[model samples]
Target: MPRNSDLTPDKALAVKWINDNVAQLSRDHMTIWNLHEPSWREYKSSAWYVERLRAEGFDVEAGSGEMPTAFAAVWSNGDGPTIGGYAEYDAVPGASQDPVPRRQPRVGVNRHAAGHTDPHSALGMGSFTGFLAAKHVMERHGIKGRLKFFGEPAEKMCGSKPVHAAKGYYNDLDAAISFHPHSFPRLANSCFWDTHSAPYWSRIYTFECDNPETWQNAGAVTGVAHGHSAARAPGAIDAVCLMYTSSKYMKESMLPHHGSWSLNEFILHAGQAAADNIAPGLAQIQYSLRAPTLDMCARVFEVLDRNAEHCAAMTHSKVTANWITRTRAGLANHAMAEVTWRNFEAIGAPQWDEKARSFAREIQASLDIPPMEDPFTPEIQHLTAPWDGEKAFREQLPSWQTNLAADDYVDYTWHAPTVRLYVGRPTLRAPNPGYRYPEWTRHAMGGVPACIDPMWLTAGKVIATTILDLLSDGVSLDKAKSEFRERTGGGIGGTSWIAPLLPADFAPPVHYRWPEYVTTVRGQEWTIPTAAP
Candidate 1:
């Protein structure tokens, strides 16, 4: 593995740039965190990045691939390999919390309003920091290459990246880098090895009740037509309920209860009438499926479609299915992984100071557990080898399962040589074996500057160094590309290669009634009211 001493003049400059701009990066992260925008509705968050990237000399195309909250930005130094990196800024609903240790929702919003959990706030700014640092170095040293920075929204649903891939946005890239804050101990401070992420497929089913009056009952020819005299048809609301219930019942049969797989549903909208017996006009339910193989996702989706059909027919409504995203399982690139790992080793892991530890102890004390001298998880402050991380990651999975959870970054693997780098986020040490910390603890730690900055700063350094290395080291870049080609049967269109699940003309489902904050007579708030009932 390469040591820190191996960093060339340009790579050293990149690291120094990031170090100098730490304060600005932190402010950017906090700005996005405060915005707290959700999937498909990252209006402010996306716009902020757009303005920022354009100011940095990138020719940015706003709303790329017809997704309103996605952007593609590029800066080039003549003709050379185009290296791609991206940022995700969308937050999650019901994760709202203040930066304080105790449980307190962010002010001026509902208790359940959107907030950063895995905290894309840091996830995004970390990559953005690295991109800017590398750009600075390239300009100062006259390095030759292209940098592609993408604004990817709605990643919580595993959205956007697949659409970007299908629309040929990533087609020109020679290499790509993906970064995520380590949410699990086994995967902290390492790059993926043999095992990567599984496939994720999401679709929204809309049920519309166009003509509830045309149901199988006739109205009597009475002189006075009483309101109660007519038979009322069950509306979209009933259809959605049936769809939800039926899917829950059939989830067990969707696939064998063996591998690491999941089927989750979210009700995007359930319309209803006030003070009347009229049927609801529209309802929407989204289902996201994650499993080890494309075949597994297909089987599960087939069952869901069958259930939706039955539910729609029973409730006198018509249902339509729209694709949100369909991503292939991850393709491993050991050579790319090695390149990233070497850079990570050189940067070392995040080092939390006494101030960060003091805040952690406050959290433990709030939870009524005795705070130790070192309250953070061991992995957060140390490095782990990719092979070692993979062994620990595979311990809970069946031997046959090649992939674990799901992430949209896997979509980039098929397009070019890609590496998914993991840096440790702040996590508390468990009080006892099998004991889990409260959700608020993680959320609070994420917002605290002292706690979260270490992780993202380390991530920025590692990514900058790696990008600089790939740009200067032809041998390393070629080795990674060779591995990518061998894995995908000669890159992209080989016999064993898998084409994008979405077609080039596939339309993104941004029109769905996704959850978002709204401004009304009551001012800005989540769709749900914040006042006490």
Candidate 2:
């Protein structure tokens, strides 16, 4: 715990405001958890944030960058540095769970309806609580600076940040703070050091059999009768199946299998209906690649394109590819990491009281395992140094690979000095060696206020303090900027700097058939129908 005398008056005010508003954070988190909007369609969640920020005296632009679910909110206290942070409200598909100890889907929704997996509900509220608390302190102290909070949806697809960066939404910031729930054990309660996130590139392939009538060996009969009687072309469904298998075979050869690279595909539209003689005309599949470098991503993409081409040719379909997102690898700023780490130490790691432990024990008992007295993992209640986390993060990687995993936050690091902060959310300890807990344990813990508030509330104080420090402590901010310039060869658009991978005029992939809730004659349900036809 930080002593009251250790903090300056402004910092104290920021901390106190966050402590007082804990109920508000809890309310907002539960509301978003219940909303559970998925990627590319966070309509209600986005509007809620926009309205709340506007009510809090910020100028908010809803539907930012031609993406209907994105927004930018800015509040300024006269002329000073501009600090940036964001909130992600988008949930993952197939993770729906109620805030209970056992397996139960959220009431009144499809069992497969989207749910807050990492519980971005807490992520958004934590950063939001910090931003608002900082704003309150700035107002009370007459501090001079600007605070920018962005409503970033579709993060599960790595969707919105690259678009925002390409369109210049992040260009004006002096620094940025990125926060996440500590989903990994190695990263608990620390800021990222040298090994930041890798690059993620996603693309969709569409195959069409529009010219099946012109296939070589079809009978001489005309359009309608020929389609049913003549030998039919293999068509788009075959193309999609072949593409999927071919890519699976080629994935091993995409790289040397050295670094932590991955290639995964999602079948968006299978294009098959009730069995009829006419061939299925259209199919679409999406490929998402994550690798340590852009060259690796490019090589994987080349093989995918070749597979698509061969599948289309063999199946007598024509294929076209569209980009979903292209993101750059992360560049680290040590100074920014250092600044955030000091603030984290002052705030201390989150403490789980007996109430939280009781919930974990209940979850364990429900899972048929006897619970320990302290059911939570040690890391959740303690802090890890940034350097230590970096070392642990690199355990599986080869010596030369610097970045690991993929996140859109990497885009922000190129724009300004950015720090990725992780505060531990609730996690239960394994009862025996190699025994894994079910997914509901995590989702349940994330939603329960008794279990989850400590993480977000601590995150709130850390972010508020860091924002105030950057606003008032010009020397520290300058050091961070200097490191960013040195790392990027002079900062944004310098000799070694990496620009936004997407073009300014690049269209957002809102038209894609992403999984979302729909209102049918039956009722509101997942695009995947709740009942059999």
RMSD of each: 1.6, 1.8
> Which runs of model 2 end up more than 4 angstroms from their true locations?
220-226
Off by over 4 Å in 1: 1-4, 221-223
The C-alpha TM-scores of every prediction are 0.97, 0.97
Looking at candidate 2, what is the lDDT of residue 14? 89
Q: Residues 3-74, candidate 1, lDDT per residue (tens digit)?
A: 549677777788888878889898888899889899999999999999999999999999999999999999
- Model 1 residue 447 lDDT? 89
Clashing pairs in 1: none
Report lDDT per candidate: 0.89, 0.90
Q: What tens-digit string does per-residue lDDT give for candidate 2 at 291-376? A: 99999999889999999999999999999999999999988988888988888888889988999999899999998889789998
